[model samples]
Target: MNAEGTSTAGATPATVTTIAGSDSGGGAGIQADLHAFAAHGVHGTSVVTALTAQNTRGVTKAEPAGTAMVAAQLDAVLADFDVRAVKTGMLADLDTLALVAEQARKGRLPNLVVDPVMVTTSGDSLFEGDPKQYLHAFADSPTVITPNVIEAQQLSGTVIRDLADARHAAETIARSGPRAVLVKGGHLGPRSTSDLLYVDGRAFTFAAEHVDTANTHGTGCTLAAAIAANLALGLDLVQAIDHAKRYLTRALKAAAGQRLGSGPGPVLHSVPVHSAPEFATDA
Candidate 1:
């Protein structure tokens, strides 16, 4: 049982575990995940993989945590926590990725959501070396990978310039091992955003009009966390992702004028409309 008085044996209120870096800017990474988890009313725990000096402008410097430290953190959390879902983001190096994959392989994790964060919105590279090899190891771990357009291009070895290209890349990346793929179209040109979900040989497209705003930091982290939160709440992958998107849309709209940092700034993770107790009362 947990502090919330919920049992870990059966499906009830989902408890999500986030493995990612720390954002000093409080816009992305573990910060965003925790905020999203709270908004979705899921119990959230985290193991920090790295610490970053970043803001809305861009990531100034990132210091990767020792692999042993990363492993120890995971051990500490899993040793005593009943984590129903796990989401990973911003692993600075290959060793950390391998460690996380190893834990998953050993069945220490569940409902994994892999957000391959390679490049920042400012075009800064987050990984130091070839991450493809390490990322490929996650293909067979029964995880759901959410990669943006640029990440898909890098992972699939193809240029994704349009919707068709995005679909092709999603299919190709899906072949690598993830049970599902969600290719985000935020980088696509103009109009509306179209995020494609590929599962079991079928493609589902979720589209929304672009909300023109500069304070879009941590969008990926929030979306992946939201999905993980929903999974923790007993929703399937499709339902979880759909609810995540809707929640993100509202968050973006609510964060329109609020300025938090000198750079791009962070979105309002707590949107009033979606804060209804009934929707997220579990936590």
Candidate 2:
């Protein structure tokens, strides 16, 4: 299952897959995941479980893909690629969630990063019902679960007002079975952000500067995908998170000056390490 893809120069790049919904806005979901994977120099494959009609403004409509189609996409990817890492987002329904959980149990999902994506950056609910019930299926499965402040609150059943509250919530959510829980601090407050990583009964905090920008559309998906990419590059759990956070910070900062839409735009996935001009290509 560790098959690698060979590039033209005979260099084999790691394969990473995202089982997620499609975002017509080109800012989040499958589009964002693929952009992140490419930025990390990994080959990306995707299984679309839902189709969302959305823009930088907000999601207007979403339709869950048929179970058969979802399963078929999964089968095709798993059969052909030696996927090194996987990230799941917006499972959309119980049936879709169950199918993914089944695959995880069967050892088909390696280095799985489960982003319990329930809401959009624009305050729109992406999935139906409480995500806590759906996420419980992955209790013993994912390598790590990434949830923002709102999602952590939902999973841990607590209100997070400060870093202390964030730590408590991370620990509580980790009890559900993920090897690690990352409670993103993007919604913590108006000051700089601090993410809490809870793993193996210990907690570590990662501080990040708050970029003054409204174009933070695909931050969650980009972070999770970046972590998956780092994992595919053979970094350990903590190292992957640290590197992913740094990558996200750069992307957010680079995206600050761009105006993509009327609402929040996406981070600059193409500029992973440097500013726009430093890394700009003519291709």
**Candidate 1, residue 244: how far the Cα is off, in Å:** 0.2
Mark the regions of model 2 whose C-alpha exceeds 4 Å error after superposition.
Answer: 1-10, 274-283
Q: Number of the top candidate by lDDT? A: 2
Per-candidate Cα lDDT values, in order, are 0.80, 0.85
In model 1, which regions exceed 4 Å deviation?
1-13, 272-283
lDDT of 1 by residue, 1-283 (tens): 3322223445454678999999998999999999988777667899998899988888888889979999999999889888999999988888888888888888888999999887898998877667576457696875689999888888888899887788888888888778788888888875547788888887877766577877889999999998888777776777677778878887888887887877777888887323221122100
Q: Candidate 1: which pairs clash?
A: 14-232, 56-264, 57-263, 139-177
TM-score against native, each model: 0.90, 0.92
Best-performing candidate as measured by TM-score: 2
- The C-alpha local distance difference test score for the whole of candidate 2 amounts to 0.85
